[model samples]
Target: MDQVPGSPQEPQDARGDDGLPGCYRHPDRPTGIRCTRCDRPICPECMVSASVGFQCPDCVRGGSGTGHAPRASVPRTIAGGTIAANPRLITMILMGINIAVFIAMTLDDGRLLGDLVMLGRTPPGYLPEGVAEGQWYRLVTAMFLHQQFAHIAFNMLSLWWLGPPLEAALGRLRFIALYLLAGLGGSALSYLLAAPSQPSLGASGAIFGLLGATAVLLRRLNYDMKPVLILLGLNLAFTFLWPHIAWQAHVGGLIVGAAVAFGMVHAPRDRRTLVQAATCAVALLAIAAVVWVRTLQLVG
Candidate 1:
């Protein structure tokens, strides 16, 4: 009669065909090593068995020996709090250029080049001779100009403080684009809103734009923006409260910066490259339109 399985005395074969002498799970098997946890037959290869059980390689990795679960991989993000990036190089170069220009203008005797470099726009009643003749360069040239040590100091300090992370995030070319466009926006707005009698100078307008851009970009990165907002608010308030300041350029630069950042960061389709290009185009048009209106008013 065939004995039922799990009988107290299952027939023990003294010699197995494999020649290990018994089932691998059997105590008598020369290599028998049942998994302590599962009590399953485990050869040397399958046996990690001990207090845990004969743990297979899969069990050791996926099961609960160490209880250290597997981790999901996260995409890399920008490294903040470090100035060792590409933007710092650009900032240093810009600072050097501005300082060089300042020194040259200071040494030029009558502040002649300095005044022109500073984009001290011609007075309303009197345009600089030949101003209408391709002096459009002044609009751009003015961005690099500064009237005094304090002016450049403040602007450069702001640049130093804000430029690194922004440049890292946006790249050197894009950072420069934002600065130039923001500068143009500021200058154009200043011309548009000026007393026509007043002259303007300094890179403060564009620096303000960079600040705005920084705030926008940080926010997009999911940063806690309470501090940034407070800082921006205080600066805006100061711009309005300070009598000598031209709030117009600051306002213009800020708007342009926000627009640029929005386009560069939040554009829906593509990798934001198209959005950046479109942003530049639109900002240029806006600046042009403002300049056109100002020129008409000036010539009229």
Candidate 2:
């Protein structure tokens, strides 16, 4: 028989090879501690330290009617993230950054775009600039760079529309992670496919990522998917048909955004934190690999 946490008895444990009990939520994780309320095994991530023995997430949320809850239990989102009073905080910050960068570029006599735009590599005879020459920051800076008013307006509007719900659902940290990773994914793909000398700059890739995440979120919540689908379809059409558009960035961001959002919304409750962390890690590794391969191709 298993014993609850702080039990005086040293009971035999049959559930684990090491004579320890496995967590109810994550059976693979062996632990001696159990939730005081339910006497259920709990791992470190699932256990919340209290005045009494550690309580599980369920117990903490339900209060267990034993006064084990915190003074003020924080509200949670659908994705198990802490709910924010202002769901649009991250969205507004992102918009501000884009706007600030645009303003700076506009006031700088139009010379800043050359420095901020994405450039994979310059030819051997050309100046020693771009990613191959160790100017890798372009991959990031390009995401925030925009030269035209129409470009910034369209992207900022899209961010305002799509960013708040995602920021709320995934919480600030995860939402920012999704946005940044999607942008990097777009930059990497464009570097790999486009001409080394080609200059590309815009928030389109990250915004496209938001669009994909919005679609995934809608599907997860069982909301009507037709609206998002129609919107995404229209954008894809524009991506292909429009002149001077880097379709690679649009395609890459959409795929990466959808993938990260799927992981965020569909991770199992017992192992959600682990799953979300793993999902972001995997996406990051993929982006690094793409950049590495492209760097090799550009320099070689």
Candidate 3:
């Protein structure tokens, strides 16, 4: 048989009486090809094409040596399917829920504005009522309700801007947890500080939380933070200066968001899930403690 100059020459033992050699990896299979580097018989499935000829799996693995890096695994989820690890699915779902709730409120009141406002004076034991009266769900529901077009518009705009990137970074579940906890933090603070007759509603708390988280993530990545810091300062100024803005929620969310983001970014890779869970638990407990103290004050 005519042999190519650069091609590997088959070994004399490559063929047995049957004119085929058993595969080095799988003795049951017969093969006509031998590895160029190791000169071992290899089946087609175990063959890796090389410049001169096919190489066996062992030879290919050996050639790569200790420098061979394993391919990264894509995670389908990180937090029990509460959030997806990739894309902005959770952000869109949140935006949709908020919009739907706003529409329902508008229909009920037949007004473009002031339809779903949660007031402090809202009768105790009623839905959307004050936390002092055991209407604890208000802490979560209020985050979804908005008073007017401009109100929902601004909050949704901010959500759209900040949510996607953060969601991508933290995965869906973690981002959702952060958002809810931050909003709860805001509501807890507002419940504690605002007068019994004072009314508050909106997703500003969650938005502010996202802002704070973004700032923390940027700082951790060593990116320039001047732009984010300036934006945060302006929003905080507006929170304090604007009338009926629920600055308490803004402040509360900001603080909680920053704390959560810090824990998430600094968590060790091996113990990430446990650490994240603990961090979330601590945040929830802190908010609950505030609520407990406030409840006692109100009852007294």
Candidate 2 residue lDDT tens string, 1-300: 222344323342447766677777656657677777777776544555455455665666666645435632864555667756577888999999999999999899877887878988876777537886889899999999988899899999999989986886778888999999899989988998999888878999999999999999778655567879999999999999999999999988998999998998778777888999999999999998999998887767
**What is the alpha-carbon lDDT of model 3 when measured against the actual structure?**
0.72
Clashing pairs in 1: 35-54, 36-53, 36-54, 37-53, 49-53, 49-54
Per-residue CA lDDT of candidate 3, range 208-297, in tens? 999999998777645568989999999989889988788888999999998887887666656767888899999999999998898888
- Which regions in candidate 2 have their CA more than 4 angstroms from the true location? 1-72
lDDT of 2: 0.80
Better of 1 and 3 by TM-score: 3
Report the candidate with higher lDDT, 2 versus 3: 2
Query: Which candidate has the highest TM-score of all?
Result: 2
Mind giving the per-residue lDDT tens digits that candidate 1 earns over 1-300?
122234222444544434533433333434333333334443332233223223433343344334443321221112111222244677777778778877876787735553364232455555462223336666676677766788788888888887765775565677778888998888888878776545566777788888898788767645457878898899899899989887888888889988887676555432446666878899999888888777776666
Candidate 3 backbone collisions, by pair: 83-172, 83-173
TM-score of each: 0.67, 0.76, 0.71
Q: Specify the poorest-scoring 10-residue window by lDDT in model 2.
A: 1-10
The 10 consecutive residues of candidate 1 with the worst lDDT sum are 74-83
- Model 1, residue 265: what's the lDDT? 57
* Order of the predicted models by TM-score, top scorer first: 2, 3, 1
